[model samples]
Target: MDYRNESSDTLRNKCAACYRQFNKKEHLVEHMRTSYHSVHEPMCGVCKKHCRSFESLREHLIGPLPKAECERIFKERGCDICLSILGNRTSLRAHRESCLSRPNNNGLLYRMANLGIQDELRIDNSRGRVVALACKMVGGGSDGSLDLCARVCLIDEHERILFHSYIKPNIPVTNYRYEMTGIRPEYLRDAMPLKNVSRKIQEFLCNGEPIWQIRSKGGRSRILVGHGLDHDLKCLEMDYPAIKMRDTAKYPPLMKTSKLSNSLKYLTRAYLGYDIQSGVQDPYEDCVATMKLYMRMKLSQFHKKENYPLATDPQNKNNFASWRQNELERMTPDQLLDISRSDYYCWCLDSQDY
Candidate 1:
């Protein structure tokens, strides 16, 4: 009479919800929710942390998940897929681009996270020269295409570096000519934005006394510099009169009678005996080249404005001044470009204080 079914005497080791074997109380409890109703699953409601299943989770759970904290962390960190919630959007975008590498495909999202909000120019008034420099290490293709963030070195005219920022771009423009300029996209993923460029520049320009002091001082009536000066002035949108600027491009004697070669490469080689090469022409170099060329051509002013024979080159030094006086006036633009490439001899003349 006391006898019972052998199966009943045995402990029910298997779980009723999922039919899974569970020897311990905890296992059974955990599996119950996993195999039972979906609502009881252990899941982070806010961050969507999934669990085994709703039912098992409900029964086995000890404490509720702090979804707010999770959400806060999520927002603090940049989400590559969802940029809005990410803390470091630039990094997130960079990861996304690396994830999807393609031609014509710039790292746009990264740029937005890093671009400088204010892109105004800075001028220093006390230094009597523009001091601020916008240094950017951009990444991407070429043709001024900027996609990634890179190191931007902010320096002053006195060789003092002011600010170094890691900026991102607001707009996505791939440096189309990246190869020509040697800019690597992978390198600029964490650089500063162009927004702060103007602010720094304005700060530098303002600290200086003023620009155009040479014109104000009545020196040369105009500043005779080199070819790329236009681009330099254009960058900051500062204007100077044509007479105030003596572009080597506009000179003719340098091109024809110098016999020094029309190209800056050959001219620099012949005059300065140095090679002129750069991954890309920088505004700083542009200013230097223009200054040098302007100084080298000062002798032309002493010329008598006539055309000399091709044979009357540097070899005929005795007749050089007179010959140039006769020939320098009739030279072409290409010729001037050649002469402007030489060492600035105007320093010698200016030394005489004439």
Candidate 2:
């Protein structure tokens, strides 16, 4: 994807979504801010405008979001009041408590532990849900426990998979009671072979989108998937996406517990009712678990009429919601994974973006 000297006639630096560009990177970024702003972050409700800068986003949402969506963001940022709609959960709560508008400080909604993600999020209110294109996870050994090894897996909307296996512990190698468990040092015997591991992942991601770019849409067009993908991606030393990822572990309702486990075994049992590994996990098996979980969640959403709140209200076509969704079922896994991003408006994560 080099934009080098091919031909001045074809030299174009258009934004992928809007087909706009500029001579400099700074201008390009600024252009994205206005054109893709609705998808990147969010627009102010009352003013019907979008955040012009980081500071402006903060000044905007200091008021309120539905109690539901507000709760989800609060959990990620450690229950802090957040002004900018783009930040994590903790910051939102901070704003809710400080802004005169924060609902009742009812301890019911403010549970310290509940500060992870909300059970129900504001649908269609923001594009964040529709844009999540992939998943990530950190596997803690193969036998459903963490004694042996930890590797992170990345899966995107197009069914692409990448894994970065851990090698030596940052902490000095030491033998603890759980030492020789599932992936015990005695069992593993040698280091993770980092170079070899890197090569395998490089090949897998050879044709897919990077995690950060996948999340930029803040909705379903792109999907980065995995159980508890956040921790593993963060640990892998990758740039964070402002949107577009499908982390089963932290997804609403299911996220009350682990950050998508990075553990497919645990996730499959909890969400899909199937066990993933007898010993070490098979990458294919892990991919299936994540896919099933995603499908399950999506199917459930389809049943809720409100999930497609924006769909040209079947009851009244005059007032249209601008999106349509019908399950693509009885199809092969490959078929499901191959879906295009244009259908991003179909996901039911929330009721707004569609």
Candidate 3:
């Protein structure tokens, strides 16, 4: 009686590994060999279906011809920014309210008012100065070959905004990427020119001291913090000393099991106990998230204080070859764990106090 189900079950070949269906058994075998679909593959947030790649996953969720059932549900409950399908309409509405709200000067005003400081905040002669920066991109050409910096924001350690501005691109914009970037052509039409923006950012980052002076002194220049800072800096045509940069994307603890860096959305949700970039990408939101992540890592209890200035210390070299055989054998497991190890020289080691 159930001929349709019986016939389909008998005819269709499925991979037990990834639940992918194939018309023929040999095809399934071939797919298993080449596809290598595993738990590590990116999965659809709505359907939990494994995609061959992130591009495939994007197509499944938001392409012209998505799965009808998943598309319907996603339309009602999914966040366009992070592409996550939340539980219900009420929850999604609450999330959208927070996600869509623009960051304002209220937080900065409160901090300044509380401190009772009328003078301008300056980074000059300051120690352990940290500033979070974020940038928004607009399409550069008709073929989407390039991205230009359209907006930038800077926030201090206290979540106080220092600078926020829109930058006009030199090249004509083919796409505003409004759905994610929340930038419009009108916003950039009368914005600051690229040259001016670059100069201003350089001044702020350098804090009145020359690059060489800051590199030698290590106190005048502010530590730049953000996610995917290389891309942002590339778009802005600006550069900072790598020693003074803290990029959350490349941080080891936040990476995937496969050793690939995690997305900011996932990192924020996992560590900060909330979601961001849900409806539109906000530079301010991103800055705050990155700053918070940096602070959290800095304040981690596992951090060893003995490894201060880990970059400059030649003795801190963790290579096993450098260690004496007797010393290595004599070391306890706990002492072995105490040996300073990092994916990259952590900038946290540069700060005397966080």
Candidate 4:
């Protein structure tokens, strides 16, 4: 089935969704089978090309060898951050102004813990909600090589402080990371113990449901949003099911063009249009940043309506049936794309369930 025997000028088999050329038609078919390119994928605003992720879309728009015409159009009207195409120069200017503006969450939203309270978060019993968690770490052990969670903060979807506490590490702290964390020796001297903080966080996140119940999907486990949650959770000596965790650093749409995780500061500026972690790191600020990011992603409304019976759906496994190979081979790339589905679940889908 090799097409290398054919002339170079002859039409080469190519994937309609990603535009990857194939030497054989069967290879293209196999690619469509595994790629699952659906309408839900991130697409270029200029050319209407579907990409595997936002990173891929960015590459298409502004990478080393972008589509010349598309790049020209995008350079004029495309939003560098969200990659949206605006109507005109004025609209693009206004859109960029608003798009890059930093969100203003009033300081009054903070509900600080009273000095008399012991290991208490003032959040009410409206369970099964989405919350963002962020923890600031201090250096522990000799030469400050080990990370210890010294502060943790949680905020509900509305950016209200649900839980915020300074944790006293089980081990002695060697570096409070004063310049970045602004945590002093006194903050940990009489702060809440790690065990108590861990228990309260676990209880709050689980919403009084047992681990098994939450794991079974029968319980209302609050969705945990964060950046680099694995590091935070590891430092805190706690574990949460992956299904309930939404790490902005790991979410495809918010990643770097290189497919690497972007730092919170970079993501905040690029996507959220604000700068964070500029000087001293605040867990509450991180919580708000992460929550804002989560909300923005969840509120995405621009993606085309999901196709029914997605290519990844079990029943749609035989997307290009062998019996219809002749018909599929004759179809154009755009036609093939119409029958494809996204390989990964879009985060916007979370809005529907939540």
Best by TM-score: 4
For model 1 the local lDDT of residue 71 reads 49
Stretches off by above 4 angstroms in model 2 are: 1-171, 175-181, 184-215, 218-222, 255-267, 276-287, 303-353
Ranking by TM-score: 4, 3, 2, 1
TM-scores of all models? 0.32, 0.34, 0.61, 0.83
Candidate 2 residue-wise lDDT, 37-154, digit = tens: 2232223323334343322333333335433444445244422122324354565555445432111122222222222211122223232222221222223433433332233333
Deviation in Å, model 1, residue 269 alpha carbon: 2.9
Preferred candidate (TM-score higher): 3 or 4: 4
Tell me the tens digit of each residue's lDDT in model 1 across 1-354. Answer: 433543432235343323345444344433332232121122432343333422222222222553455545444553322112333667656645543312111113223343332232333233333222322334445565433333333333333334444445555546524543334454445544445543454334334334445342233222224453354344333445443445454343344222322555444443332344345423233333334444444432232221221222354233224445435434432232223212212222321331
Please report, as a residue range, the 10-residue window in candidate 1 with the lowest summed lDDT: 101-110
Location of the lowest summed lDDT over 10 successive residues in candidate 3: 111-120
C-alpha root-mean-square deviation, each candidate: 34.7, 19.3, 13.5, 4.1
Off by over 4 Å in 4: 1-12, 103-128, 215-219, 257-259, 305-313, 316-339
Task: Rate residue 69 of model 3 by lDDT.
Answer: 82
Q: How good is model 4 by TM-score?
A: 0.83
